[model samples]
Target: MEKERREKEEREEKERREKEGREKKKGERARRKRNREWRKRERKKGERERKIKEKKRERKKGERERERRKRERRERRKKGEREDREKEERREKGEREERERRERERERKEKERCDEGERERDRERRKRERKRGERKKAEREREESEIGEREREKGERERKIKERKKGERERERRERERRKKKEERREKGEREERERRQRGERENGREREKQ
Candidate 1:
């Protein structure tokens, strides 16, 4: 009975040791699994934070680029305005010069007209002096002079007619050129307005895209 009890006690002790060893191994496996899960969670969180940080940096960079581009556009627009003003000033200067030249040309033409009138007066006085001679000789002289005068008058009339035609054609050409300039100005204005509208639409599209 003592030997049987001792054997039974020894078996119980061995069983208890084996059960404790198995529970310790199970606990180690659970700890390893929890460590792996914690490492995976930490890795995922780091990745998420890195991605969010990168995205924020990228967004900030994009905003800076956009602002820089906007500033450049504004500067370019200001430069264009300055250039336009310079061009306008140049055009006005050219117009003033043109007016001065036209006035000078008109004064020269008046002087020429006065000289021609004086020449005509001298010719008439010579004709009157010739009329004071003998009757038949005077009549012959008058006929020849009248014939010459008629030729001169015909040539003057033809010259005047040619001048009139040239003036009319020049007036017509100037009118056409003026009309073309006006049309070009109108077209340019329309194009500018259209470009503005297109830019507005593009801005709206970009806003919608961002949203």
Candidate 2:
């Protein structure tokens, strides 16, 4: 009996020891799994931080480029303004010179006009003098024509005096003939008067018949 009890006790002790060993191995495995998971999480956090830093660097570079571009644009605008001002100044100067030239041309034209007017006045005076001289010559010619007409009248009177006797005989014959013509013209006039009186009497008879 005592030997059986000792063997059994020994067997129980061995089983207890084996169970403890199995539990220690399970705890160690769980600890190693937790450590691996923690390391993975730390690696992920480091990657996120690196990405954020890179993004910030890119944004800073973009901002600096934008500033540089803006500065260059401003400088170009100022330069363009300066060029425009210079062009305007040059245009104004050219305009002033043109005005001066125009003034000089106008003055010269005015002087030429005055000189031409004086010359025209002299020419008009010369024309007027020539017209006066021509008029005087025409009057003298008309007076000479009048004097010749009077001399012709005197010659005609002297010719008449030389032919007075013969003219008297011809005059007697012409007077006899003129008296016969006058008697015939008087008879014709009396016949015309009688015809007019007959026409008036016929017109009155017609008027009486109508009435």
Candidate 3:
């Protein structure tokens, strides 16, 4: 009986060890499966987060490109407006300069015309004055010639009268020689009368020349 009891206790211990080993093996296999499923879910979640980040980055890049294009367009518009304004100003300046040049030319032409007119008037006045002077000189010369001719004729007539009177006095003296004293006294008185007549005639001639 002691040996039989000892074999039965050994067999029971062996059965208990085998049962505990089987339970441990079953728990280990379950834990391994749970770990594998957790790893797979984590991988899927990581992939989804990566895709979301990529989409956000693409949207931000598009916004930046659009902003750059808008800035370029605004700058181009401002430049075009500035250029147009400058061109207009240049055109206006050219027109103003042309107007001023035309005005100056007109003033110059007017001044030339006025100067020409004044010169023409001066020439006409000088010509008239010269003609008047020539006419007066011709008149004066003609009057002097006429006066000289009249004086020469008067001198010749007086010389002829003196010669006739001398011939008459010589004839009278010869006829009265017989009446001596009376004849001499008559001759002296006649000579005195003749001298007085000659002096009066000279005085009359001098008065005429002065007049």
Candidate 4:
């Protein structure tokens, strides 16, 4: 009986151990399935986070590109304004130089006209002086000619008066000589007549006494 009881006890023990081992294997399979499900969830969450980070980085890069384009446009506008201002200044300077040249030309022309007027006045004064000198010379020559003519007339009158006085003196001398000759001839003829009368009377007396 002891031996049979012992064999029975051993079979029961073996059965119990076999049942415990099966239960333990079933729990281990349940634990391994839970772990696989949790790992799958974690992997899906990591993929979602990486996609969000990549989208944020792309948006930041686009903003940087827009800022760079804006700066370039501003610089180009400033350069264009500077070029326009320089062109305007050059145009103003050229106009100022042209005005100065025109003013100088006008002044030169005015000076030339004034000099010509002075020369013309000098020529007129000289011509007037020559005419005055010629008139004075003509007057002096006429006066000299008149004086010479008067002197010739006075000389002719004196010569005529001297010739008339000489003729009157010769006629008076001839009249005195003729009167003396007539008086002498009358006295001689009267003396001769008286002598003839005396001789005739003496002859008559002598004849009477004789008778």
- Enumerate clash totals for all models, in the order shown: 0, 0, 0, 0
Candidate 3 TM-score over all chains jointly: 0.44
Model 3, CA-based lDDT: 0.68
lDDT rank, highest first?
A: 1, 2, 3, 4
Backbone clash total for model 3 is 0
Model 1 C-alpha lDDT per residue in residues 11-98, reported as the tens digit of each score: 9999999788667756875786697679769966986897699679868976886697578757865775687578657866975687
Better structure of 1 and 2 per lDDT = 1
Residue-level lDDT tens digits of model 3 in 50-156 = 76996698679757856875787578557755775676578558756875786577557656776877657755865675578567657755675576457646754
- Candidate whose TM-score is highest: 1
The collision pairs in model 4 are: none
- Show where candidate 3 strays beyond 4 Å: 1-12, 110-211
Per-residue lDDT tens digits for candidate 4, residues 87-188, read: 546744765576467557755655677677665774575467556745764665456446644654564466446545654564455456545544544564
The TM-scores of all predictions, comma-separated, are 0.46, 0.41, 0.44, 0.39
Task: List the global CA lDDT of all models.
Answer: 0.72, 0.71, 0.68, 0.59
Which residue pairs collide in model 3, if any?
none
Q: What is the C-alpha lDDT profile of model 2 across 104-190, one tens digit per residue?
A: 775676666768777677568657865885687578657855875676577557655755755587568868976996798689769
Model 1, global lDDT: 0.72
- Which 10 consecutive positions of candidate 4 have the poorest summed lDDT? 191-200
